[model samples]
Target: MAEDRSEQEPARRPGGRTARVRHRILEAAAELIARDGIGGLRYDQVAELAEVNKTSVYRNWPDRTALVADALATFSADVAPLRDSGDIDADLVDFLEAIAAALSSRQGRALLNVVGAAHDNPDLRAVVDDAIAQRLATLSQRIKAAIETGELPAVDSHLLVEMLSGPVHLLVSRGTRELTRADAQRITSIVLAGVRATAAQHTIALAGEHDGGKTPAARP
Candidate 1:
C-alpha cells in the first residue's frame, strides 16, 4: 500500500505555509519518537504522519539529530507553563500533579527516550539539555515570586525546585506507582516543611554569626 500526503491531508495552510509545514513535520517527528523511540524514527514515517512531502521533511531538517532535537524542544516548550496563583501550597501541588501526569504520558516516555539516548548522541543531548534548562528557568522565576511574596524565605530556588521534582521523577520513571492527587499533597507538604526548617536553620546560623560566632548566653 502506498501512502500519499495529499490523500491524507485535504486542507492547506493559508499564510506562511513553509512555517506551518515545518511545525507539522516536527509534530509528526515527536509522535514517532514517542511511539518508537529515537532509534526507530524514519523520515518517510514522519512525512506520512505529517501529511507532507518527504522532501519537505528533509528540506526542513537535513540531519536526523536536528529533526529529533527540534521536535522535542518544540514539544516541551508547548507544555503547560507554571503560574503562581497566589497560594504557594496549592500552586506547588498543582504543578507537581501536572508533572506527574506528563511523566506517565506517551510524550513523557518520548522525552525519557531522548534523554536515555543522549549519552551516545551529543547533538541531541545538547538540545535536550537546553530544553530542560529553559523549563527550569521558568520554575526558578515562580520560586522567586514565592520568595518575594514571603510565601517562602530566601532559599535556593534551583535546589528547591530540584528537591520538589527529583523524588517524583524517580518514582514515576521507576514505575513504582502512578502518582495520585494524594501523592501530590504528601510531596508538597513534606517539601514545604523542609524548606521552612532549612530557612529557620539558616536564620539561626546567621544570628550566631552576628553575635561574633559566640554561643548565646542563657538568661537565668
Candidate 2:
C-alpha cells in the first residue's frame, strides 16, 4: 500500500539562483561588517559588491537590521547541527568540531565584529539580540532533545548553552591571537566533562525527588 502523500515530510527547497544571490549579498555584508563593523554597512555598497541594485536589497530587506539578521541566520544554517548517534560523548565531540569550524570562518569573525559595535549603538542592539536569541533557541532545543532521549540527564539547557558557547565568544571578542582547532577541541573536552558531571548531579537530584528525598546508591 502506498503511503499517504500528505503524511510524508515536505521536501526541502533547493538552493537555486535566488539562494545564490542571497549568498552573495551575505558575503558582501560580512566583508563590509569585518572592515567597518555594523555601522559601516550601506545598502549601496552591498548592492555594488553583490552586483545588484540597491532596490534589490531593499526589496528583500525592508530595514538594515533585517538584512544583517538574515545574513547571520543564513551563515549559521550552513553549519552542521549536533547529531545524536545515541552516544553522548561522540555527539558532543561532533558538536564541538562544528562550532570550531564556525568560529574560524570569515562570517563568524564578522558576527563578532558586529556584536562589538552593537555594544555602543542602541539601535543595533535589537538586531544583534534577535540574531543571538535565535541561535540560542536552537541550541536549547537540541539540548532538550538529548535529555528526552536519555542521552543526557535533565539540566538547565540555557545555562548549559552558556557554558558551552561562552568560552568561544570571549575568545573571539578578546582579540585572542591564536585559537587553533586543537585548542578548541581540548577546551570542548574539558567543558563536556563538566557538562557530564552536571547532568549526573541533575539525575541524582531527580531520583531523590522521586524517592522521597532519599539519595541514590553510589555507582561502582
Best TM-score goes to which candidate? 1
lDDT of residue 108 for candidate 1: 67
The global Cα lDDT (0 to 1) of model 1 is 0.77
Which tens-of-lDDT digit does each residue in 1-220 have in candidate 2?
0222212224464455556666778788887886777878999999798876666677778788777777776555664576667776566556655665575566776777778878777756766676556555656777788889976666788887777778767776676554566656767678767777866777788888899988874462
Clashing pairs in 1: none
Per-residue lDDT of 1-220 in model 1, one digit per residue for the tens?
A: 1233333344474335556677788788888888788989999999999887788788768999989878877546755468778988888888788887776665566777788788987787897777666656767788899999999998889898888877777778788678888888888899989888877777777788888878563232
Q: Give me the displacement of residue 148 in model 1, in angstroms.
A: 1.7
Tell me the spans in candidate 2 whose CA falls farther than 4 Å from its real position. 1-23, 54-62, 120-123, 136-138, 174-181, 196-220
Residue-pair clash count for candidate 2 = 0
Prediction 2 global C-alpha lDDT? 0.69
Candidate 1 segments exceeding 4 Å error: 1-17, 212-220
Worst 10 residues of 1 by lDDT: 1-10
